[model samples]
Target: MITNPSTSQLVRSVSTELRAKVLPELTDPALLVEVEMMLSMLDMAAVRADHEIAWMMQEADGIDTALSEAAVEGELPAPVRDALHALQLSRPADLTYPEVQRHYGLASEALARAADQAHAGDERLRSLAWSLLEGRVDHELATIGAYVAVGRSENQT
Candidate 1:
């Protein structure tokens, strides 16, 4: 059986073609800047297409884990507690992007509260919340690094 090109592959091909063919022929500085921005966005999208869902799920799972741990040791704010209970009852693996995003929004609020509590002297909860936040930031930074590397390579070539 034959399969079509994956989304990332298609995006990479287009970005490569634009860089090698179209970019050189363009004379307008403004148009060149626009095209370059488009290329960078496409590159970022391609990277995300390859990993965003997994990252989302991973993030959700981490939030769930942190909430569960926090629940065992201390009291969470009402909104966070409710959101965590809802998350626990649902299957995260079955969630779509929008659903995950909604849950993530709730988790963010809960995390913020957790951070506040942590600063108020709850070291255990603070550690868990910060771990989740740090992991997320690291993931984002990796994606940004990939885009920056692509931009650097384009500049070099």
Candidate 2:
């Protein structure tokens, strides 16, 4: 059995070759900017290929935790009650991307539905959900890594 080069390696290899071989001979400003955009997309693709699944799984886990806590609270708000009912349904049997994506969607929806209730244990669950959302923002920031439009007027320096 042979292992394949990772998406990051493949994309970086192509980008590097293009930078070394192609960029040197290119004189068109428009084309140079376009190539830069393409390189940025390739970089993003590499990062997503490496980390998207793990991030999704982590978010799903956090959402499930919140839902589980919300489910047990007495006199639950309608959103929490509905989310708890929705969550009681079984998740997908397979753990493929599409299946996991579907599972994440359902769980995320459940958590969003219960985001506003601030009574009793509901407040704790909402707080947990807020923390999870903050973590999600952190993950996204890590993924995008302080992106700024490179060719923008403000970026001209």
Candidate 3:
């Protein structure tokens, strides 16, 4: 049986080959700089390749969950409530990436508005809103941490 290279492996291999074989041969300084930038982007993509979809799903789920919780509280502004209702009506699993992202954006805006209202009047809702935001931030940091780790390892070598 044969196994296929995973996306991360394929990306890393291409980046390594470019750095070792192609980078040194480039004669134009501007082109060299551009190639270097491309390599950096490739490195980040390689780091994200294995986890990108999962991260996106997690983000969408978090947004959905936050919106649901806010909706139940009944203190959200009318526009925010309507937006959350619209988002809730669409199943995240049934949506494409762009659709999910758009829903998440709407949810995020609504969440922020709810959080602001909570901050002024409701302690429990405020805490819940902050928790959701913190979770989202943590998820983002985990992805960023992978890129930072790659940068550190490259610098150390």
Task: Give model 3's TM-score versus the native structure.
Answer: 0.64
In the range 1-157, model 1's lDDT, one tens digit per residue, is: 1156988888888999999999999877667777888898888788887887778778777888878887887777666687777777655445577776766666666677777767887767777878888988987876665444333346643
Q: Which whole-number lDDT from 0 to 100 does residue 51 have in model 1?
A: 83
Between prediction 1 and prediction 2, the one with superior TM-score is 1
Please estimate how well model 3 matches the true structure, expressed as its whole-model Cα lDDT. 0.69
Clashing pairs in 3: none
lDDT of 3 by residue, 22-52 (tens): 9879777667767776887787677677776
Among all windows of 10 consecutive residues in model 1, the one with the lowest summed lDDT is 148-157
Deviation of model 2 at 152, angstroms: 5.2
lDDT of each: 0.75, 0.71, 0.69
Off by over 4 Å in 2: 1-3, 73-75, 88-90, 116-126, 146-148, 152-157
Of candidate 2, the 10-residue stretch with the lowest lDDT total is 116-125
Off by over 4 Å in 1: 1-4, 92-95, 116-124, 146-157
- The best-first sequence of candidates by lDDT reads 1, 2, 3
| TM value for model 1 | 0.77
RMSD of 1: 3.5
